[model samples]
Target: MNCEKIKESVSIRTVLESFNLLPAKENRKTAFYFALDREEKIPSLSVDFVKNKAFDFGTGKSYDVISIVQQINKCSVSDALKYLHKFDLSVLEKESVAEIDYSKNYEIIQVGNVRHPALVQYLKSRKVFEQRHLVKELVYRFNGRKFFGIGFLNDSGGYEIRNKYTKICLGQKDVTWIKNGCNTNNEVIIFEGFFDYLTYRMIEKEENSIPDHLILNSTAMLFKVKDKLKVYHKISLFFDNDHNGRDTKKMIQDDHDNVEDCSLLYIDFKDLNEWFCNFIEKL
Candidate 1:
C-alpha cells in the first residue's frame, strides 16, 4: 500500500482526539498541523501530517496516519480507517479496525527462571552456528534449535560432530536418518527440536534403535517436511501438542500412510523437554 493513500484513509482528527490533542474549538473549517522542526513542542505527541507526520512522542517513532490509528486502536490499517466512522457520529467519519488478539509468547518448556546455558553452548559447539557460518541460528532453546542453512554442509566435522557422513547438522536443522537392519524392518519416528535429540541421545547414547527418524526444527516447518516423507514406506510423526503442533499433526495426516501422531504419549506440556522435566523421570 502506498503511504500517501494510507494517510488519506485515516482521520487525523480521531487520532488527535484519542491522545487528547484535538483542537480547542470544534470548527470543521479549522486545519491541524505540527512543526517538524520543533520535536519538543509538538503537542508532546500529535498526529503530524506531511513534514512531521504522525508520531508517538513517547517512542520517538513516526508512522503514516493509517499506521498511527492501527497502533492505538489495535487493528490493521485498512480496518482502522473504516472504524473511524463510528468514533464521532456528528462527523461523516467512517472506518473499521480489525480486532487482533495480542498475546505474549510464553515459554512452553522451562529449564529454569533463566534460559538454559546448554542451549546456547550447544549452538556454539556447532560450526554451522559460528559467526562465519552462513547458517543463521534462530531460536536455540532447551527444547529445540532452528537453523537457516545456505546449503547442506558436506561431510565436514566442522558442522556436525556426530553423523558427519549423513550430511546432517544435528542441532542446526531438521534431520532425517534412515538405515537398514535385521528382518528388513522399517520404522519412522519424529522429534521436535535438537535438544530433544540430545535428550534422546542422553538416554540412548550410541544405542539409538528407531530404524529411521526425522527431527522437525519447529512445528511451523512441518508442512515443508511432509513432501520429503512421501518417499518413505512408513512414517510416524512425533510433534508437540501445543496449538501449532496440533496444527502440524493435522497437516501430516492428510496423505501419509502408517502415520502415528505421538502427542498423546506425553501431554503434560508443549513438547519433549517439558514432558521430560515434569513427567518422564526414568532418564
Candidate 2:
C-alpha cells in the first residue's frame, strides 16, 4: 500500500495497540504516549487521531504510519511497507470508523446561576474568577454519569462545559457573544475559548476600554461566527499561539480590513488565560 492508502485504510490506534504501546494520557481525540525509544516519566509523544499524525513533542519529530512501524520494528522503508502489505485493509477501515464515538447523549439536569464552589475554584485556577457572573453552573449527565461544570451558553442553547480536567459541550456547537461591552461599542475582541475572554475581562477591568467579546469555543466553528463578526466595525483577535489559531487569525484579517491580531500581547504564552495566570503568579 502507498502512504495515502496506508493512512486511509489503517487505524493508528489499532496499530499502536497491536504493538502493546500504552498511552500515558488520553482525551477524546488525542493522546500522549511514551516515546518508542526510551522509558521517560513524562510522555512526550503526542498522537492526533483527527490529523492522522503523531509528533514526538520531546524531540520535535513527526511520524506517520510508515515511520511508526519503522520505529517499532527497527525496519527500513521497504520493510515497513512490506510488513503493512499483510494487514487486511477492509477490517482496518471498519476499526477507524469506530474510533470516533460522538453518539453520546448528555442530559442537562440543571442550569442556573453560578454557585458551585468547585466550579468557582475551577475558574480561579484558570485565573478568570472575576468573570463568574457572566457564566452559569450546569449539572449534566452522559451514559448515566453525573457531572457539574462551569457553563458558557452558546447561541444554539448548548453550554460549553469546563472543569479542572474536562472541556466539552452539550446540545450544539457555536460561538458566545457579549455585545453590551459598554453599550454601542463598534469593536469586539475575539477569543478561541471562553477562558481567554474571561482573562481579557480580568486584565482590562477598566470601565472605558471594555469593548464587545466573542468566544469561538472551537476553532472548527470559527467560520460559523463570521457573519456576526462583520457587524462589528473593528475586530481584535486573541487566538492561541498555534498554527490553527494563527491561520484562523489570518483568515479573518484577510477578509476584514479593520481586523488586528492581538496575540503579540501574549506572544510567549499559548493563549490569554495562560499569560494571565503566569503574570499573576509572577506578581
Pick the TM-score winner. 2
Poorly placed runs, candidate 2 (over 4 Å): 1-104, 181-185, 205-210
Across residues 1-283, which tens digit of lDDT does each residue of candidate 1 receive? 3446545644465455445444422222343334233444434444443342555456686666566567666788668666553333322111111121111211222112212232232333332222223222222121232211122221221122121111223232334343435313466566765545444443444544445656665565566666767766666666777777777777777777777776675777676555654443344
Report lDDT per candidate.
Answer: 0.45, 0.78
**Residue 63 lDDT (model 2):** 89
- Backbone clashes in candidate 2 total 0
Per-residue lDDT tens digits for candidate 2, residues 170-227, read 7777888777746466888888998888888777756665678888988889778777
TM-score of each: 0.36, 0.61
TM-score, candidate 2, is 0.61
Q: Which residue window of length 10 is worst by lDDT in model 1? A: 94-103
RMSD of 2: 12.5
Best-fitting candidate, scored by lDDT: 2
Off by over 4 Å in 1: 1-183, 203-209, 280-283
